[model samples]
Target: MATTQSFFRIQTDANLQSMQVGSIMRKVKSRAWKKQRYFRLQDDCATIWYKSKKAGNAHSTCKLRWLWKPPLISISDVEAVREGHQSEVLLSIADEFPPDRCFTLVFRGRRGNLDLVAESAEEAQSWVKGMRKLIENLENMNERERLDQWISDWFKKADKNGDGRMNFKEVQDLLKMMNVDMNEHHALRLFTMADKSQSGTLEDDEFVLFYKMLTQREEVLRIFQDYSSDGQTLSCRDLEEFLREGQLKQDHVQQHSMELIEQYEPSDTAKMRQAMTIDGFQMYLLSPEGSIFNPAMLEQHQDMSQPLSHYFISSSHNTYLMGDQIRGHSSVEAYIRALKRGCRCVEVDCWDGPNGEPIVYHGHTFTSKILFKDVVTVVGNYSFKTSQYPVILSIENHCSVEQQRTMAQHLTRILGDKLLRNALEGKGSDLPSPEDLKGKILLKGKKIGGLERSLDGVVEDSLAAEVSDEDDAAEIEEENLHNDSIRRKPKKSKQGLSKELSDCVVYCKSVHFNSFKHSRIHSKFYEISSFAESKAKKHMKDAGAEFVHHNARQLTRIYPNGIRTDSSNFNPQEMWSAGCQIVALNFQTAGMEMDLNDGLFTQNGCCGYVLKPAFMRSVEKRFDPEHPEIRDGYRPVTLTIKVISGQQLPKVNLKEGSIVDPLVRVEIHGVPKDQARQETRHIDNNGFNPMWHETLTFTIHVPELALVRFVVEDYDKTTKNDFIGQYTLPFSCLQQGYRHIHLLSKDGTSIPPSSLFVHIRIKEGT
Candidate 1:
């Protein structure tokens, strides 16, 4: 019996050695002490095993908690891995044994940095090479390869039986992992469908087929067919006709058609194909090589040092609610989604909740409530994930003094050093720039005893002095009657704010608006005023130049008026033209206004901040959106776009059978006269690759203030045309020559490879 056990133990040790690249005795700082651990790199992941101290033997049991896998293990996650590093006292295990010859690995995670040391330089070098190779391989994978790898990893986890098959229970668990919650009956039906042999289990191939079914884009294929003249293919001549006039006199149209056919057709063919098949069309639509979003446009090399007021900030109103403000589900997901989409300013209406904690919700409404602490935690984690620009927490305070203090504590503790506690530039006379406040959170709300004391005191004293000067007896009687009437009306009183919470309002101290003249004299660097849409519009109409000049220096936030109960959005371009930085919108709603907002900020790297136009930024010049032709250096420009072809256009309705009548609309939004729109004639039954070869042209006076929007809609004789997909971009960013316009869903997510091929030309006009 002893001989048999010895043989088994020898075999196990041999197998372990063969599987590992290298193993070494390392002192790892697992809590406080430096314990000797056996570290090894095997199968792309690093494992640390605790050495048994009693027997001085390496154990097979590993510290499973220390294993790192892909998606989490990225090149950016590793800070440094050095060989022959000098002993660092801070991370060293013992005082006597200096780590001069040891290999040190430094990695960063959610909590903080972690350091691991190897016993010798050779062992460290081996581990570092393995880890570096793994990270590089993962990062270099294309989108399709990455998706395949993820699917394979998920399959391994789901196949619990170890026989390459999953039962109904396992399949249900897989769906849960995919975040799909289906009824038991539905899940059973799906399982049975995948289990062709009625064996009550799914094989590996069957599982893959099921996954493909879940991810297949039938709508895209249907739309492709809608564009094709023949059921199987789309002709290049038709494509050319859709992009330009059918006349043969236009040389550019013929050149564009030949170039597209050569680019999209299969190269293996003996001769250049005049048409594209479904497979060729689909591949062209989904590849990133065909993407229209220029990578150079998203580079973060722009100067972010301008004051917060100098940039147009992407702001959201009622950010806690996902639907209507009156009856919506308030969740931290709203804040997360908005921040991840590069929104810099988010509104949080805090009201008193159970216990001393405050909760965020719409007051005097039926909207659901979320804990304020949870919202802060989400903000702390995701605020800088998408963009390094500063975030503004627009707090609408309705909490009591104690609850407000608790809110402050939550912000300090959860945000830690990320919160901006004081002026970034030592209380300078001017507002600090966004660059100076990067990775910091700013609190914007009312503060205690921070109102204009001089203005308030003077008004109160004047009223008292005038009242004391009443001399005539009959006048006294008349004054008494007036006083009785005034006493009958309810008087407004100011509420006290907690000093602890008040100190957090260093820059964006919310204040009430008086008049244009008074605000000019009283507004300070630290104080910003909010105005409703109507009020702001009235100011612009009454004094356009003054309002433009005021916004050049002071920060003004314009929100939707009370009448917009449906949470609709105003045309942000009007406010942007006037240099208003924060044009807060109802992000939950989707419409033309939202499209314009998304387009304007799509430039400048989509950092949620964009530099104002030169004329709007200049203090000497006064520009008006309504009269752009009067501005100096403004000239008329003609834009010609050829609607040539579409690849994998999405069907507007899944239930409208397999056929669709698709059309392309060219919308030019700018000053009233320049806002011209036209749509091409709808093609019957073709959805896959449709060739219109029609050209549309427009002359606009102000290209700087114009947004060019490409919309794809499905025609229906019974009702209004349904929207399929759209792409919007600033006219300034439009590239000349033949280019593909990638389509985006209504919610601003890229629908891969679905694109419109067009030839765009912009020429200076009269």
Candidate 2:
């Protein structure tokens, strides 16, 4: 068990501290679906519980106003709190409820947003400010303190009687809720030991001790003993040896050791003597520095001053769809989600609508439609929230000149200074860098003529040029996607562009791809080509070197083919290898492909742009991803990982008495030669403290482009393995030595206390 005390502390505002007395507010799902519900923050300050009408009628209120239920929202799960009619759901009721009284709780993960309308604006303000404060508090918590808070919240949940204490039966129920199926006899023995009062129940402090006893990692203790000089703590020299030998810290080893000891060692005596206790060592192992991903890559460390073509941009296709392309709902919430996830390029399929307005949706489909103005409004507001880099609005214009003028007006009015209206003056053929275009929005669509025409001048000043058949191609792709037997030639001619909309295309002029040589000979630097995934794959295979050289000079975007109606994604690495800058995926879909995309952009301050590798950026290199050995600065590495054990893996099934048989899978995604997969044997009938003790090795040839994914799944012989949690990162960001892989839910939110412990070793020249 942990040392005799708990280390949990929460600093709360005076208003939140007095929140035991809750308030009543209207919970709204849609314009017609609004109900009054009582909401209250739990005493732990980590959960917000609201009572349903049925529960309110049948159950008596507890000390708090809300009923004890499973529908409570954790404070940490809230991604953002937006005021006014921010969401499409909220904006629909703009006439019913005033903007000042409406607010939305934008939850992380796949959970739907909670729209609420307060009786007064003051009530809405209080909740928004209060919820933000609790989120801030959770964000500021250290690892230990966060664990302590988690344990506390569990304790509150397990105390079914609301008596401030949990009996043995209640503790058993708590164990199941925490995703641990432990041996009953073993659990009782530990429970008896923790109940020092011999009262057969655990108070808050006793529960903390019990948690420690149940979670004590003998594997970690063994490592600590191996490095400890006197069996109690590790001296500075001992730590230095561990850092140099095991962690691959070649320079300033002694300094790194001392800094870790001074920062994590809780005991003043230990800090003064330059020693690390077991607790301190474990704490250090769980900190960000000891995380599986390298902390250095978490900042803006890459050079961003290069041309726009010299980087990979995180992009989203069909940015307004929340589901399948044929019949999905179109909402502004999709744009918010993409932008918040550091997406720099988003596609909008604009078609003519009523009132001279342009609407966004897949054409010739039953998918719902949303106003283009609303989409632009959200983009203007949230574009720079996650990344200050430029956002490319990939426009698929199927609108006439009249509605196109309205679309142009909305762009200039709603986006204002954020939109790049005027073309860069006298910049030759080279496009600008992301660094130079920060906080700007660039339209990616047809330009009627050259970009020299003034944006504020007359709409008739620009020359009209026939737009490409890209929109026609889109219709043909959809037709082929649904009916493979029906093959029709794409309509050759399309409507010309409106000069008003054409002026907004400062850069990223969409052009049809004929050939690489044709582009090099005739295309300007600002011009770009959009390719369907199948077409891009053909070029990557047929002319890999030429594709790389072509991308080294101008921007290329690869989007998913129309056949993926389920909104699935192609492996982005395939396009990245060809040096394609914008490889658009369905951001609403969560899968391995998006995981790798997130990994690449997560570094470099998560600014949506990552610099292309040196070999891919050089026109002289003429690199081929299919032949990595020929690339410059190709250094392979050997990654060795010991699948030591798991700590409290989340159960995939919530069915009563259901337990997980967890297995760990490690995968490497990169150039063809470097891709590999290895997994550990499943541990049966245990989600808590399952030890694998297996080792998996991989040889990553192109380390710069490689991504390592660690996954946990529940084994089931009768069906497909159910996913539990996973963490993925760039292979170069993998840190050597003992570390913890903090797992994430399928929707990419941290699943606290669900993690894997492993010892990593990396050596050069694999």
Candidate 3:
């Protein structure tokens, strides 16, 4: 069956200078055992042995030969050995030495002898040189091919579909196995680059190109250059090597010697821009030779610390240098920059623009313009790390309800599948979708008790548009709207917390309602000069921050444990009995205040007097000295309010059949002198009472049965225009016989002495 007998031959001098070619084959194979060896060629001075087989196969056949003419070394082997040697430190002679002159090649276990092709020694040497050169070239090409094959193997493993190609999904899963995390956009970007044909999959040749691009140094030149300074090579002392070694150097290790070795050589910052993740670098090596390689991947070196180097920078603008020179920063840059700096949460302000697009801005009304949708555009296009996209986009919506919903839809449309789909597909179908993110997103809206709007519609709509093929598609869209609405009814607060909060708090109270004398006194010590005191408070609470209130109504919304409260007027003992800790005191109170009191400070936690040297001494005497009741603290008190009266509060109704818009009118009143005095002086200190008589009317318009609330809290409270008695107001109306509001904690405990419970019924034709 076999036309030619295949075997291996060993050659040496008559003096037996070498015993076996087995050792040489073993040495060559040792370095790349994980890789397959499809071809092996071994040669001695007078004889040659050759083996060829596929990768992953252990057995190979060998043919032995002799020179019919004078033998000469081939230039191909010379080049192969030369290239291999130069690429590795261990194979130092690979490039520099001639393989024919150095050693012989043979098969490990094959047994045979060979026919002679050359006669004279000189002729044989010349013949061997020529043949060896040809063989060397073949080997060199094969080695390159072998590397390409390795890349193909990796691609196939990642493909998962056995399609001989890989998509973004497959690459993503493979990256996970390698402990390399990549975002869907980034993964797709890389996959698209490797796909070449744009087939959404990578073929073997594409895979080979990818493999070559990844391992090749061209794309990662800048990164590697960054790690190496003054042309000094990365060695055992480098952080990567040290991490691999897992050995810590002793403190006594000589810094002088290391420095003398050019460790102190200035590193080029420009070069650092060239660096990329090792994975990215490897992927570069897999790229096709002629294709344009995007070196953008090697843009940051800051996160490449000691052990695991996972950071990749795809563009220059998204990169943050070691110092403050942000590459491409606009006013919107701060938000994204914060994420690059590793902030887990960020504050974003949103407003409805003339175009009705949601835009980001810190100002209010159209006069202070910033588009919310623009912020989304910047973020979606310019994320540094895929995971960093999860960083909270804290939004403060200072607009009307319809506008707010429209803006939310605007965000959905802009971010769309690019941002939401990848995040959703990566998750289980059983979980709630984007609709669940509505209230969870920490957006500021008009809700009295910090009510969370149902995100079911938003989530269902987002998911309805995009779903993975693996998911059940039949009933998804059909059930989305209806099921979402049913699932979306405002989640009632657990136990009695929601009910209790409803009872005590007023939904719409203003600082102007407090007395002028009290307000003046309050204004003099701190600065709460605005009638819209609750605006900042609302925003802060939405950001998941804890707000402390000076009054019971403002303090009524504390639902979580870690948030501390310090009341100035309420019975500290009574509040303590109500599970509140820390009693805060007001500095505006004339005489001696209680000791052990945690004094609430302003925004910077620095007494306003700190900005001026003249008042510093008085501040020091009152606060810095060992005062009995005043302790050190810097928490700001926040207040939330709602308006309750409309018919009296104005009431209108719409039945399932009737056509009348529900109307309610609420008057916001500033705190008066009596209430201020009562709060400042002890409640038992004579008949001092604070009354809120001045009213500024605000209107409420909502669909029938819409559970609406107006949440107010103070973010910037100063002593200047301070409101005394009550701060927050909360109310909800239903066309029924009885109406009541209650206040409860984040846990479920109710605070007594909330607002008064009222009952009302209107006749058909009043």
Model 3 residue 115 CA deviation (Å) reads 77
lDDT of all the models against the reference? 0.66, 0.84, 0.27
Better of 1 and 2 by TM-score: 2
Better of 2 and 3 by TM-score: 2
Clashes of 3: 140
Q: 124 in model 3: Cα distance from truth in Å?
A: 62
Clashes of each: 27, 0, 140
Any runs in candidate 1 off by more than 4 Å, and if so which? 1-294, 448-494
Residue 8 CA displacement from its true place in model 3, Å? 56
Scanning candidate 2 in windows of ten residues, the lowest lDDT window is 1-10
Superposition TM-score, candidate 3 onto the true structure: 0.20
Q: List TM-scores for all candidates, in order.
A: 0.61, 0.93, 0.20
Identify the leading candidate in terms of lDDT.
Answer: 2
Q: How close is each model in CA RMSD to the real structure?
A: 14.8, 3.6, 34.7
Quality of model 1 by C-alpha lDDT: 0.66
- Return the clash pairs for model 2, or none: none
1-766: candidate 3 lDDT, tens digit per residue: 0100011111223211221121112223223332211111223222233333233334533543222333322222131112111112223343533333232221111111111212233333443444354444334432233333234434545877665566766766655543233356765766678787888776666765654443333313443355443433443244243222211223432442243223222334322433233333222222221011112212221222211001111111101111111111123333343333332234344444575555543231112333565556555543433222222333333443345566556555655543322212432312222223221212211222211112221222122212111012212322443533322322211111111211111211112223333542442211111211133233223321111122211211111111111212222211211111112222112111211111111111111100111111121222211111232331211111222211101001122221112111222211110011111111111011111222222222111101122111111234322111121221121212112333222111122112212222222211
Candidate 2 local distance difference test against the native:
0.84
Arrange candidates by lDDT, descending.
2, 1, 3
